[model samples]
Target: MVQRLGSIGKLLVGVWLAGVTVATFVVIPPYQGLGDAGRIVIVHVPTAWVAVIAFTVSAVYSALFLRRRRPDDDAKATAAAEGGLIFTLLSTLTGMVFSQIAWGVFWNWDPRQVTILILLLIYAALFALRSAIDEPERRRRLAAVYSLFAFVTMPFLMFVAPRMAESTLHPNCAFIKGSDCNGITLQVGNVGLLGDQKVQLLGLERQGDIVVAQVKVSTPGLASEAILRPGYDLTTRSYTDRPTFPGQRFTLALESVNLERGEARINMEAPGSGLLANQRTLWVFLASNIGFTMLFVWMFLVRSQVLSLEVQIAQRKVALA
Candidate 1:
């Protein structure tokens, strides 16, 4: 069974490599400001996800080991935690590289950055505690308990804590945008699908023309205001205002304005369609996620085999005595 599982794992590793290649070379377009460096997203984001998954798996098995007193469950838990740590380290390194490009500094002590560092230390301590114990059963029991205790901090650090902070440039805009912005919803067509009916700024652009500008949408009841940069020019048909630099995140808002009719219509450009966008980002996201998940499973299978072999060797030594 171990050999068969190992063979399957080897095959999947090749698949993972292929997926990564495609994600890097084919999918995912260059982001604004990030340019080609944004390709690191394929590696960093996936590794972080795998790290979280591996830790969760370790915690689950640790709970199972305590409940049933199963040596196999303990083995699985230990192996999973080790794999999780490896991915977490990779995630941290990649994130640091990305930070250097985006924030102009390698280590800025951001909230998310500090939290991940703390997580790494916690798991490192888990391994240290296991190593100090000489007896197999005792070591397994203690490790299982420690794993459960340590896991309490995972969710808080990875998800909740970041949200509570005033602001973060981590590119996690799903929960919140900027410090004051609650959320963002793109205004499309003749009327908004959501929010109150209020046309704050009308007659800014000509009645029938394409406007290339950055639009910032603030949620309902918020003091935040939307900004359209590089004000439109009738003659040049180009943005002459403040142009966006590379790697900056901005949405290209398309709208039709008519002063006499008092009608303004706008819709966000499809992702990866603009000159600054890369279409393959979504594909890269999928490939990275699937590839690393397979890798974690493979690592677990190999580790489990080694652990079982060690157990057999120990039993044989006692029998000889």
Candidate 2:
């Protein structure tokens, strides 16, 4: 059964990889701001997604190990975590490349960057703790418990911390709202885009010489005639401000911020059209994420099998003794 599963996994992964490659290169449209460089998103986004998914799977298996005291469950948890760490490193490296292009720095202390670093350290410590322990049973139990505890940081580090931060060069949907990260919320009557009273602009997109933006803003007690002003243009992106004018034109600046009442300003860039507007890019990104996820599963299964084999060998040695 294990051999058959492995063969099937390998076959599926091959298909997934081929599809991702074609979609990323041949099918997807170039991003507005990043252009051909935006193709990196297909890889970078999927790597990060797989890392998080692996961590989630690890946590689930850890919980199962604690409840059932099964050796297979323990092996599965460790394997998933190992895969997660590997992809986390890839995600960070790819992000650095993207950062160098977007922000002109390889290692800026961006909020998302800092949080992901913290997450990597936490997982590295998990492995270190496992290695320091001598007894197999005790180590497995402790590791399972530690994995559960560490799982709490995953959501906060990857999602919550970045959002609560002051400012970031990273995209907004890196944590929440997903595809909606680059869009503005237009208040219809009372409810917000997130079904709340408040709204925030995720980011902005620009086209050629003209800056195009659509914001749906409604702040109770704030003026109905809120204006968006374009601030500094750093030659790469542009920022907008909430001036009194409704229809204003501006050039594409690197970090143009549009200041809103009681809200921190969001940096705007013309990353081409929105990802949603371009169906091909959207499908390519989606396919890439799914492909990487399948790769994660394959790695996890292979790692678990190796661990399980080692466990069996140890059992046989004990019997001989």
Predicted model with the maximum TM-score = 2
Global CA lDDT computed for model 1: 0.66
TM-scores of the models, in the order given: 0.69, 0.72
User: How well does candidate 2 score on lDDT at residue 130?
Assistant: 93
- State residue 149's C-alpha deviation in candidate 2, in Å: 0.7
lDDT of 1 at 13: 87
**Model 2 misplaced stretches (Cα beyond 4 Å):** 173-267
lDDT per residue as tens, model 2, 242-306? 22222211112223333242122332334335544577877778888888888998999889989
How accurate locally is residue 3 in candidate 2, as Cα lDDT from 0 to 100? 84
lDDT (tens digit, per residue) of candidate 1 on 119-199: 999999999998899998999999999999888899998888976775454644311211122322333222232111122
Among all windows of 10 consecutive residues in model 2, the one with the lowest summed lDDT is 245-254
